[model samples]
Target: MKLVLSPEQRHLREAVRAFLASASPLPKVRDGYDPQVYARLNGELGLSGLIIPEEHSGAGAGMSDLAVALEETGAALLPGPFLATTFAAIALTRVPDKELLTGIAEGRIAATLDGTEVSYDGSAVRGTLAQVLSGMETDVLVAPALTGDGPVMVAVELAGPGVTRTVLETLDITRGQARVVLDGAPARVLGPRPEGGILDRLCVAVAAEQLGVMRASLEAIVGYAKIRVAFGRYIGSYQGVKHKLADMHCKLEQAESIVRYAAWAADESPAELPEAAALAQAYVGRACFEVARDHLLLHGGIGYTWEHDAHLFYKRAKADEVLLGPPRNHRARLAQLLEL
Candidate 1:
C-alpha cells in the first residue's frame, strides 16, 4: 500500500496551509470561535464535508484526505467546531442520517460525540455528560447511552427542550468544552451502538492533529534557535540545545510516520485499522506533548509568558494528549489488541 500522500493530497495540504496562514493566524486563535471564519473554511473550502459522501452533500473523500486538512488545522490552531464536527460526521456515517449529514456538510449543523453514561428509554435519553467537545454550541450530540436491552447510539438536539449546557474553561481555550445535562431530552436512536471502527477512525484523526502540533513545535524552536545567541554563540550551536532539538525532530519524524500509516489503514485496510490507530495514539500523543514541552523550555522564560505563542502550543499539546484518553490508555488498548 502507498504510505506517502498522493499528489492531490500534497496540493490539498498546500491549499489548507495557505488558507490557514491567512485566515487563522496565531493572533486570531486567541479571539475564540468565529462563525464567519468557520463558514469560509466550510463553505468556501468545503473542508467540513471533506470526508462525507457526495450523496449527503459532502466531498466524498476518505480519511487520508481529512488527515491532510487536519494537520494544517492543528498547525494553525484553527479555532472552531471542525474537530467536533468531524467526529459527529464520522459517527453518523455508520447509520447515515441524511438530514444530519447534509446539514453538517452545509455548515448549518455542528455536532460532537463521546460515549456517556446516560440512560436511554425508548425515545429519549436522560443523564449528565460532564464534558463534551464543542457541546456549548453544538446543534446535535451523538453518543452511546445505556438501555435495558444494551447500549445504543442516540442523537439529541441541544436546542430542544430539557437540555442544559454549561461551557467549561479549558486549558486550550481555542477548543471549547462543555458540560451537558439532559433531562429526558428527546433523542433519535442512530444505531445499536457505536462501531469499533468509529473509535479507530477517531483515534487516527486525533493522531494526525498531534502530528501537526509536533511539526509546528519543532519548526518554531528550530527557527528561534537559529537566531537567538548566548555566550557569544548561536543557542542552536550549543551541544546541549542541539541534542534536545534533535530529539524533538526525531520524535516528530516517528509521529509523522505512524500517523500516515494509521490514516492509510483507516482508508485502505479495515482489518489493520484498530491496531494502527492504537499505535498512533500511543506513540504520537506522548511524543507530541514532549516535543511541545521541550519546545517551550528551549525558548527560555519567554516561552512560558502569556504573550508568546509558545505557551499556546504547549497548552494545545497537553490538551490533545488527554483529548482521547491519554497515551497510557492507548498503549494499554494497543497491548490488548496485539495480545502482548
Candidate 2:
C-alpha cells in the first residue's frame, strides 16, 4: 500500500487547506458555522462526496482522499456537520441507500451516527441518546438499535415526529452536539449490526483528523517560538524549550505516519485495517492531545485566555481523544487483536 500521498492527493490537500484558510478562518469558526460556506465546501469543493460512489454522483474516491480533506478541516477547526455527515456516509456505505447517498453527496442532507442505545420494535425506534455529534444540525441519524432478534442499524429522519433534539454544552463548542430523544420514531432498518468494519473505519477517520491537529499545534508553537523573546533571547533558543518542541515534532511525525498508514490500509489493505486502525487510535490519539496541551503551555499565559486559539486546539484534542473511545480503550483493543 502507498503510504506517501500521490500528486493528486497533495493537490487536494493544498486546495482544501487554501480554501479553509480563506473561508473558515479562526474568527469565522469561533462565530459558528455558516451554511453558505459549508455548501461551498460540499458543492464546489466536493468534500462530502469524496468517498461516495461515482454511481451516486460522488467522486468515488477512497479513504486516503477523504483523509486529506479531514486533515485540512481539522486544522481549520471548521465547525459544522462535515465530520458528522462523513460518519453517516461511511456507515451508509455498508448499507447502501441511493437516495441518502445522493443527497449527502449533493450537500442536500446533513447526517450523523447516534452512539446511543435505541430499541427497535419491529416498526418503530425508541431511545434517548445523551449525546450525538451534529445532532441539532443533521437531517438524518444512522443509529444502532436493539431489536428482538439482535442489534441492527437504522436510519431515522430527525424532522419526523417523535424525535426531540436538545442542544448540549460541550468542551468543544466548535462542533454542535445534542441530546437526542426518540419516542417510537419511524426508522428504516439499514442492515445487520456492524461489527469491527464500521468501528475500524471510524477509528481511522478520527485518527487522520487528530494527525492534522497535532501538526497544526506543532506549527503554531514553532512559529510563535521563533519570534517570542525571553531574557534577551528567543524562547525557541532555550535548550529546554527546544527539546520540548523537538519532542512535539517527533510525536507529530509519528502520528502523521500512523494516520497515513491507517488510511492506506482502509483503502487498499482491508485485511490489515483493524490492526492499523487500532494502532492509529492508540498512538495518535494520545499523542495529539499531548501535543495540543504542550502547544497551549508553550504559548505562555496568553494561551489560557478565552481570546486565544490554543484552547480551541486543546479542547478539540480532548474531545477527539474520547470521541470514539479513549486511547487506553484502543490500546486494550490492540492488545486483544494481537492476542497478547
Tell me the whole-model lDDT of each prediction, alpha carbons only.
0.89, 0.91
TM-score, predicted candidate 2 vs. hidden true structure: 0.98
What are the per-model numbers of colliding residue pairs? 0, 0
Candidate 2 clashes between residue pairs 3 or more apart in a chain or in different chains: none
Model 1, TM vs. native: 0.97
Give lDDT: candidate 1, residue 11.
95
Q: What is the lDDT of residue 69 in candidate 1?
A: 93
Model 1 weakest 10-residue run by lDDT: 189-198
